[model samples]
Target: MGWSLSLLPPPEPELLDAVFLSAGRALHLANAFENKCQYVLRIANLASAFDEDPALTLDEAIAAAPSDKMLGQTLHLLVDRFQTPVPEEAVGLLNKARAARNFIAHEGASLGSSYIWVARADTLIRHAVALRAAVQALSLGDCIVSRWVSEIEEPNVPAPRSWDDDYPPMVDTWVFGHFNGLLEG
Candidate 1:
């Protein structure tokens, strides 16, 4: 005869809260990284296509690049098609981040159930924190690439609006500081 197992107790509210917070941050950072990749690819495409088709507008150029591709494919295009020079370290970080993002997207919920059932809330939180770190590092690399793109296209691009003008004081400060820190490194 097979033995029956009792259901485990629910996870602590605080542990659940931590997991949610970290998971949210990881997902947010992953999205931001994807956006940066799209921007880089679109701008690079514009730079090349504009000379050949003077009538091409930014919107047209952006539309020309496929947006449905996965992150790995997007990275490959940036390097191979656009000849964007990503540093070796940045490439490693991007790969790591991509893996983390994919895992969280595809299996996080399923794995989370197991962790919760086993009362491994700390492990779940740690996993989320690691994913967030990887994505955050990837974002820094994206920022560097963005800076490079801006420098190359400085003459064509207009001045950016001040952060303070668009965001509340607290948000503006945090935004400014976060970007400044990323760019500085």
Candidate 2:
């Protein structure tokens, strides 16, 4: 089972916007990570199915690569349908941004305080954007495959699959797990 944010009421516009933006970025990165996982998994599946066959050239191999939209859809399905909590680092950043957003939304203060909030908000946004770009870079299927080949060594290899492959691909569980991870449980 997973936790539900829907039970809560809507937050103030300014603060809510910031929180939503942070959430969006977190999701974006999480999706990227998942896509990379799938890319490698599918490639392995292909290789495993066609063992010792070097018939396809690099160009032919790329032609057989998954489409960009397919990759995006896979990530989207993993994130939206599965709802895995994002990594701790991403959630921590989101929490910081969300707290700032909450202060912005609930607290009615002067320009000085607002300016401070805005500064923090901008920083959070910048960090989120950078994270998103790095995630997007992983969309290059080659990079994803290369990472798996390089990182997971033989004899005790971690299977190259998305987190969802470990658990049932349910969105609520992912969200709950991610939130729990953020809270350090």
Among the numbered candidates, top TM-score falls to 1
* Model 1 lDDT per residue over 1-185, tens place: 13222365546545544555545555655566677776776666667777668798788876675555677887777776555566777677667656755765555434343545454655655555454454555455545455545656696774454422332233223323333332222
Candidate 2 whole-model C-alpha lDDT, 0 to 1: 0.40
What lDDT does each candidate get?
Answer: 0.55, 0.40
lDDT of 2 by residue, 81-116 (tens): 223554555434333433333333333122232232
Which candidate gets the maximum lDDT versus the true structure? Answer: 1
Each candidate's number of clashing pairs is 0, 8
Which TM-score value belongs to model 2?
0.29
If candidate 1 were superposed on the true structure by all CA atoms, what would the RMSD be? 8.1
Sliding window of 10 residues with minimal summed lDDT for model 2: 108-117
Question: After TM-score superposition, what is the CA distance of residue 48 in candidate 2 from its true location, in Å?
Answer: 3.3
